[model samples]
Target chain A: MPEPVLELDRLVVRYGSFTALHGLSARFAGGALGLLGPNGAGKSSLLRCILGLVRPAAGTVRVAGRDARRARSEVRRRIGYMPERDSFVPGMSGVRALAHLAEVCGFRPDDAMLRAHDVLHFVGLGEERYREVAGYSVGMRQRWKLAAALVHDPDILFLDEPTNGLDPRGRARMLTVIDRVRREHGLHLILASHLLPDVERLCDEVWVLDRGRLKMADSLERLTAAARGAKRVRTRPEAAAALAAAARAAGLVVADGAAEAELVLTRPEAEVAPAEVFALAASCGAPVLGVRPAARSLEDAFLEALEGD
Target chain B: MAFRATEYERFTGRRARRPVWWPVCTATLRRGWSSRWVRLLSFGALAVAFGFTALFYFAYQVMPNWPTLLRVLGEDEGMASGFPVQFYAGLLHVFVYPILLPLSLLFGHDLVARDLTSNALETYFSRPVSPAAYVLGRTLAYTGFLLLTTLGPMLWIWAFDAATGPQGRFGEIAFVPLALIQGLVPVALVLALFIQAVSSVTRSGVWTNLAVIVLFFFGFVAGQILYEESDRPEVVSVPAASGGRNEAEPAAAAATTPAQAPVPAEETADNGPEPTVPADAPPRIRPDRLPLALLVGAALALVGGDPTPLLLAAPTLLFSGDRQDGRPPAAASAAVGRRGPPAGAGRSADRRPAPASPEERIVVHHDPRLLAVSITEVIRGWCLGCLDRSYPEEVRRAQAGRRHRFRATEPRQVPVDLARNVLLGLGGLSLLLLFARLRRQGTVG
Candidate 1:
């Protein structure tokens, strides 16, 4: 019953003639929220509108119960944004640049400097804090950006493609740092990423967008839990329709699986046994090629959201 | 203590309501002052100030005893007695032209452009600072340095002049500081905004510096060309009056034109009298040319406060060859002493003047000084000359209102002072709008 961290009211964003967000309306309660979409899906545009960078063509965006447009500075003060691109003040040491940004965000000078050092330490840039941010390598710059975002200690954090372009070790390090920040600090998060596993590991809620439309918004728990008691059935491409019909006729909830010629069958009240799935396919004049349990995963939910009407 | 990369720690300290632009201004100052070129130039500016003060002191002390030495140094007879108005004018020229100009170039090239090149504007706007505040902070940083270099030393010299002069000299020259401020502040503010605007366009420090250098070089080159061309005699055709047949009518029509091209005095002396067109003679076809020299001179005048450039620009505007008919006259040297029967000139010849009408005559009068002096210089010089001529008596008058003197006689120098003021005002406004646009596009796009 606390105000949702973000409330978007039929938000419409356009760049010249092209619409980026088509009347998006949603409310995100405070928690780790994952925004999942492919390229040009308006994920970054939505972040920009929330950050007060892009003015909406129509409708309103509210952050923490304040109008994002009217109260932009106040709203921005409570939110830290890690942009998708490599951004930093040139000619400044990493620590000094972070401190300058913190000061810009209204932090006391001494406290800003101390917080800058501490955040750098937290993000594993403590050793390179004295080096110019312009000289930082790809992974180091990513860590430095994360450090900058955290230096202000805002209430909500917006991370745009945080793990982008990172090697395996670097990606793991970034995720670990983000996870620690979210879990230990109890900060609210609105993380926009294309990597679903990264979301699954950190976020409890998800919003899926495709081509400027919000396809689904729900708790990650329920999205994945809906796949429980389901079996993934793979058969010949020609037998897909017959197997799906058979499973539906058996009073099971059936949907398309993530791969070709596959059907996922679930019963809301009970478990869907693989042997039962095979029997249903066999009786319906469909070949029972393979049967396996459909484990809970965000990828299935995400792809389903994209695939759904 | 051993270093450890650990969990994130929240900042628990209190926040302050410091002006958001403070950090930006300070950062700009710090970065610019940290540059080796800027520091070295700053010292050079200081050294120039000291050297000028010493020169003025020595001139006042030694020049009085040796008029011959004063004459050798090109010191007019009046300057040998006391620090004249030229003292302040000379001070402004030395301070702005040599010391502050390059210093500003070195210090200000990267102020805004570096942020753009580094893609830091988004990070800046992502904070609480507005575009206006960002621009203001940058301008303030550059303006502060210029004022420090310009007004700071000028005032020191003025005080030195007041202290070292003969008794009661302070009362005579009390208006010098006011004049310095009136002249210097706008130059500083305009330059600060101008460089930043240039930076926004070029988006690189080195390129913006190059652009500034090119613009100045063009101004210098254009000023020289205008000066040479304006030094020549020009031929122009006067249009006959609409209904009048008297001599005054044509003269009145000619007076309406912005400037009258002067013929060489020798040519006029040899022509015996102003030549009249016979009614039977055919008129020549010619058209009026736009005043290119005046415009170029006015534009170049906006760059400096020394007034010498303005003086140089004025003659070009007034006397540049604007041939109304026939092929462009050969250079100034070739056109002299050629007095032939008048050819049909100007489209106005179609409305043929009656044989008895004096308007049919082509009158040419020449003043040797037109090529050497601009109308603005004439007016400004007249004001300054009046002050210099009346120096012993008009000190009280000068003290009462020397600042308003140029503005009061604005009708005389309209083409010069007005154009300079309008260009400066428009230039400042355009720079402001450019900064806003840069911020708006930078943030979202």
Candidate 2:
């Protein structure tokens, strides 16, 4: 078996008297791992600890099977970190700053420069690469930071709040770029973000942290599989309410779908049958257009994980 | 135009450790060099050095008898054979005060301060660099520019002077090259460390520059006030009340004697006929009350250099003084500040013979240590003393002969040396603290 990309053995992090991470122990082999938590939930602290920016109060953090604290330079060289806050070298153009960071990561000058250009282009910053980063807009700066993180092409990427200050369009573009990188390069990703949809789109596994403790660590498939047997019923908007009422009367669990003309029906004891959903729609005089298996939003799984502890 | 493909390709090139600090250092240098003002100032420093060299050559050629006059007066011994050590001292003084200090301030004001303000340290620390390596890279960048601006031009001037002057001039000042290193390297280190420490604390480049300027100005003013208020009889005028006896004895005595003889103010009128003081003579302006540029220009004029180089050197030395004090100007000493201090001036091992009724005597006194309060004087003194201490016996004699003009009896004093040691210790401590703070911040945050 291959070694885990990151191995945490009872890792603890504290700032003064405040403990940020309490005995975080996990092993991530290699995959897109989403870290979900609310504010002050130790998501950033875990990232920092793994990146070797913060020393563990006790236990150890290993990156690529090397002790993070002892082999900090090696660990940092192997992992690329995008900080939660806006960070860039002042007075430097986007491409030059990216190249400078690539060089600092031990890339040869020519290779670093070439990688800088390529990464900037990949992040959709090729047009504005010549502009000083200080003058870049908020979205541009975020993209530039992403380019800086990717310029050296490390084995793992720890992106802290990658979509923090981005607009909706900008956020989608960023996610697309990140998804492409993950799919094409096969790099291990540890993405910490508050946006659930973004995580659901990119990450296959999830670690939920709350108050510095790991609440749940599981594959996304297993966590969201509970709601998969439920059936979604889509009917005329005028008859959706009647269909929901009819389903509830028939001893079936009924809930609103994500849209106005959609109704979700489930059974607690058995698989929710599409025939039952269709029968309820017919009885309610609703023209049923579709009856399909429903998938639970990751938000449900994330919130449940937070409350499950 | 055809569209070019812009795609992200895998970087298959090999990566290796070539000292991570090199990128940091080169980036810093590139940023500083990109500034138009920095380029202008650097070029201006070199040009001024060239102009000064030309002026010195012209002066020597115009007044062929001046060397003989200096020898007869015992002011210097090597003027006919080689450049006097005092000339080098004066040039070093000019370089440190007018050239290097401002250039460093302009170039390094934002070195670390901006990174902290803009939160760029995260990006830097995210790489395979420790805080120590980052600080080392920054200090090296600053020190490299300092050497380029000051020491580079200094050597160029020396070579130009040697080649242009009479034959064998190079061999006469062979110790100069080594002395320059002894002098400049420490000063550069101290300045770089000090500025880096300051930059670490300040959040803005403007604030860093302001803080440094204010600290230097206040220290200089405090030193000047302390010297003026103290009762030490350090000032020695050329013409004295006691028929030149007071002048020659004390000047010679101050060369080797540590203990000083004090002459009170009232005793001068009894010894010599009181020179009449005009009631309307303009008051002597304290040098601290004058803009630093004017003082630099005045110092240049006092050295009898062409004033054209003043245009290059003056504007950059722009420390404005606060002259709110309403104290009446005293007599006979205004010229003292205008020209170089009389022989035996800064040494306290002399009675100044009461300054010949205060109106007749030119009371010239300046402690080189107190000038600018930027450690420049200490560096110059260290260079001179280093030459004396490090040279062979024969070379020492030669240096002693060349140094007869300044007559530095004991260049190193216990108190001033203690101050220098304290300053150096503080600078080193600050750098260490900066390293620790940066690491801690990076870690905890």
Candidate 3:
């Protein structure tokens, strides 16, 4: 209804003659939009476009109701950007870097210092804020980067691969921060991630990219539901054969004795009643110890989409 | 619209504060002082100057028989040595300044160029600071740096000389303060001019700097062409140098001795049977009514080095030195014009009839006062310098006659070389352009 937070219209990015992003169109509103893609799929290109750090050849980008190509400074002021690669100003203290970002965003030194401290603390950088980023670990550096991007208190955030190089626990912490920033700050977010778990937990919608094209863009629910009939049911190691046949008869795919074989489901996307699966397991001769919805997997969706294409 | 405008004006008033100039200047000064290369350059400039000064100091100390240092600087010395003030002035004009001209490149060279190269110009251009501000900020920082590097050495020399020892009554013989101030003025002028000259090429600081260096390496000739265009083409055109036009103006004066006037060592009381220079009340020199006028004239002459700059300065020196104690103006001017066999004119064997002699010279041929003034006029006005313009056919024929040893008219001539002036003029023009480019890039994005 109202103007979307971001609208990338047929954006084409070319490096010389080779187009990196070939006229891709997409729009996002005030919610977390997850961008899931393989390497070289122009996902980072999309975020750069939103930040107005890179110009598109063919189409326009409307960011926060302004044409990004024209009112770049205005648009950039409203959007916080976290680059895919490390953009740390090495040799500067983490707090200092945050302060610089705030200053660049028009904060005075006193206010910038105070805001820097707040953002550092928000990203769990508390006392380590005084430490030089040169001495920081990958996880700490990653958090510091988040603090810089957030210090400006922008309305919309563009993060390209926020969890790309983090440990599982680090990735989990980042995801929690992202969700909190969105919910508490009422900020719109774009997260580019390869790990589907991050998207499932943090995104309100998803954009699946493969080979520089938007192969799938829909609500997270519908995106997963499209692959519903092929969901696998996990069973105990002993009764894997009978479990598979019965699941096949129900138009479901069940892999035998795989990891997490203690749970069973008709489809990964189905809203299964856990207690029902728990009770029906014994009669099928594959007693289920527990049951839950199968995690949505971008890898599987990506492979299947590539095959379909 | 009225209500919104009123509110906007109030908001603007609240936020329109900017930093004061001194703090900005101090910040700029600090930036340059702290730059590693800048530290090296400033000290290097001083070390070079000190070396030149020491050579003079040592020559005075070791060879008491050697002529005073001023003669060498004044172009009167048969042998070439150095003068500290003159050497200090020259190092800047000749070496340090030409190099400093292009430093504006460090700031602006990255302009329209590096933005496209790094894909970051978008980020820079989007900042509230405009392209103009960026360029101005960069130039401020760089020129401030140059001042620190150049003047820092001079200040040290002045302080050290002032603090330390000097044996005799020339009040420690330390021209350091004058030399120091003079040292900086020319450098600042030259660098300012060069910055303006080279600024139009690119938005890049490095390229502007590089262009300056490259121009210097090949001898910047474009400005020479410009100079040729601006100057009276028929006048004697010495090669233009890039720096220190302010301090080195007196180096070529032919008549009146400069502030550092060379008194021959042989003429010293030690060797030539003392002609008493009274130690007690310091030569009872008469006060001229126009000392300030003379100083200003000296300064102008030093800047342009035209006879006007010198003649205006020389009157008092002549008035003070003309009489034994007191005399009438006409007789004094004539008495000083007398024949003492022209200083450094040559052996008796080289003598021929003096050509183009002053009417004032025949009666007062023995007086030194008239001699100095007459000679100065001849050097400034009648010394034809070039073939196309700097010298006239008369000078050429005279030069040709010097070879023959016998010629028609037997014309007495005063010779000043034209080729050297052309070389200096061209050199100066090129250096100015180089600095102009540097300044432009440093100033505006």
Candidate 4:
């Protein structure tokens, strides 16, 4: 019902003869949308186009219902960007760098300073805010960049590899903060990353890209749904063999593992039901703990999408 | 205390719409001042200012007793009375060369280069700041710093001079501050933008500083070389001979009828009688031939035909001189006066028949090479030497009878005008080029 936060119509970008993005036409709804792509797959280029940092060779980039090329300043005002690189004003303290960026984003000096302090605290750098950015560790630098990006309170936060180069704990902290920003602050988020699990955990929708082309754009729920060929079953260890036999006798393919059994449901999922499985389990005199749709992981879905392209 | 309460709160407070450049300008100024070297240099500038103020105070205290003081110091009376304009000129020279130039170069070397190397330009331009605003902010930062060192001290010295100097002369020198602003502002702006433009292209601060230094000092060195070579004896010999011949025709005719001329005894006593030339000898050249040739060459150079002198003395050309006294150094005055007939030419006509006229009394054999050497010496003295040393011995000879009015013609004024035009043109062109380069690089927003 609401306009998409970012819309690209047949966008094409090139540097000399090497095209970074080719005819990337997509509409990202106003929610968490993960931009999944391998390195050099035009993920950064696409984000740059959406932010109006790079001009599209062909087609249009509309951000918040305005032409990004024509209304660049207005568009940028509505969006916050955390670049993948270590970009910060050198020799400046964390608070000063954030405040400077906030001021450039159209805030008064005092307001910017207050907001910088607030954001630095929010990003878990409250104590280190006074230290120069040069002295900050890699994780702290990432947090500092996030604080600067969020200091302006933009409508859409464009984070390019927000968790890149972070240790496991630091990555978890960053992910948690980003998730909170999206859920609590209620701002549209475009997360660009190569890590599939991070995307699957945080984003509702996923747009997989490969070789400058969009492989698939759909909700994570729909993308990783049951592959329409198998059902996984959980039952007593002694009952797993009997359950597989019953499943086979019921005209479904079955494979038994050590703890559970998987049924290759020859019949469509529309026709198969939990009641049928329960009736079969009773006849076989086996206890059935649970039966659910077996779906591919996000990594599988992403690799499959790229494979199809 | 803890900022926990405000953490993760959206900054919904009303945002203020300030000029985009103000934050950047303030930040740059703060960063620059935070550096220890900048603080030290600023203190040095202040010390120089106070030192000058004290010097002026002491000079004024001894003004009434200048004759006795001059005797005690074994200095000429001219040095005491000629304090206002020349003194300010020396002060300006010291400020620009040693203090302001180095400080500006140091401040500007990293201004843009750091942004580029650290990729902060993306952060800056990704926001509401435009390229023009970025440039304006950075340029203003350097300009502000340079002004603190330059205009601040200059005004301090001017205040001391106005208070200690004669009241009647105050009106004349009152505009020195204005001249300084007009003169130094462009110098500062040009240096700032020029350095910024260079920084935009390179990522190393050392390289940027090197480039700026090379540009400023190399231009000065090259200009000095060109000026020396162009004003050399070989280049002026033929011109001086022709100039001498043109003057000799009228001078020889006056010398022939000595009975009709009844030269005054006082005039003859003051300047020994001019030597008579044999009718078979070549035309005699006046001792002032070399200075005349230099004056002519400098005038022709100003008309856009020749740029040797203009290029060499660019800084001197752009200088507005001490506006308070209205009398720039004599060398500058003479350089500017080149377009008109030579100074004291009219007086030469009236005294020509006297045979011992101060102008004709110093005649020597008209050798083209020798005349060229004379012209070369005068130009070298005026162009490369200090103001006191710039006056040619020929001009000194003519001033022997009227030492009270001696003013060495300053050739720097010619280059000053030329330098202004050249710098303005270069600044405009460099700005355009910088804009285009930034656009092409597409590294901003």
TM per candidate: 0.76, 0.73, 0.49, 0.70
Q: Which ten residues in a row have the lowest lDDT in candidate 1 chain B?
A: B341-350
Best of the candidates, DockQ: 1
- By TM-score, the best candidate is 1
In model 2, residue pairs whose N, Cα or C atoms come closer than 3 Å (at least 3 residues apart or on different chains), thus clashing, are none
Candidates ranked by DockQ, best first? 1, 2, 4, 3
lDDT of 1 by residue, A1-309 (tens): 688899999999998789999999999988899999989999999998898888899999999999999998898888888888988887899989999999888888888887888888889888898999999999998898888778888889999999998999999989998988888888999999999999988899999999999999999888877577778888999989988888878899887877999888888747898789878977988987778888857887787788887
lDDT of 3 by residue, B80-162 (tens): 22233333334434334433443333322333343333222233333333333433444455555655555555555445444
* TM-score of candidate 2 versus the correct structure, residues matched by position: 0.73
lDDT tens digits, residue span A1-309, model 2: 888988889988998789998998888888999999999999998988777777789989888889888889888987888898888898888888998999999988888777788788788887888899999998988888888888888888899989988899999999988888888878889999988888899999999999999998988887776577788888888888888888889988787888779877877536787777767777878899888888667887788788785
> Candidates 2 and 3: which is better by lDDT?
2
| Residue B178 error, candidate 1, Å | 2.3
TM-scores for chain B, listed for all candidates: 0.60, 0.61, 0.37, 0.60
lDDT (Cα, 0-100) at A294 in candidate 1? 84
Residue by residue across B359-382, what tens digits does model 4's lDDT show?
221232112112112212222222
**Of candidates 4 and 3, the better by TM-score:** 4
lDDT of 1 by residue, B139-208 (tens): 7888888888777888888887777766666776677776666556666676777778778767789998
For model 4, what is the C-alpha lDDT against the true structure? 0.64
The alpha-carbon deviation from the true structure for residue B172 of candidate 2, after best TM-score superposition, in angstroms, is 3.1
For each candidate in turn, give its C-alpha RMSD to the true structure in angstroms. Answer: 9.4, 11.8, 20.1, 12.8
Q: What is the TM-score of chain B in candidate 3?
A: 0.37
Interface RMSD of 4: 1.9
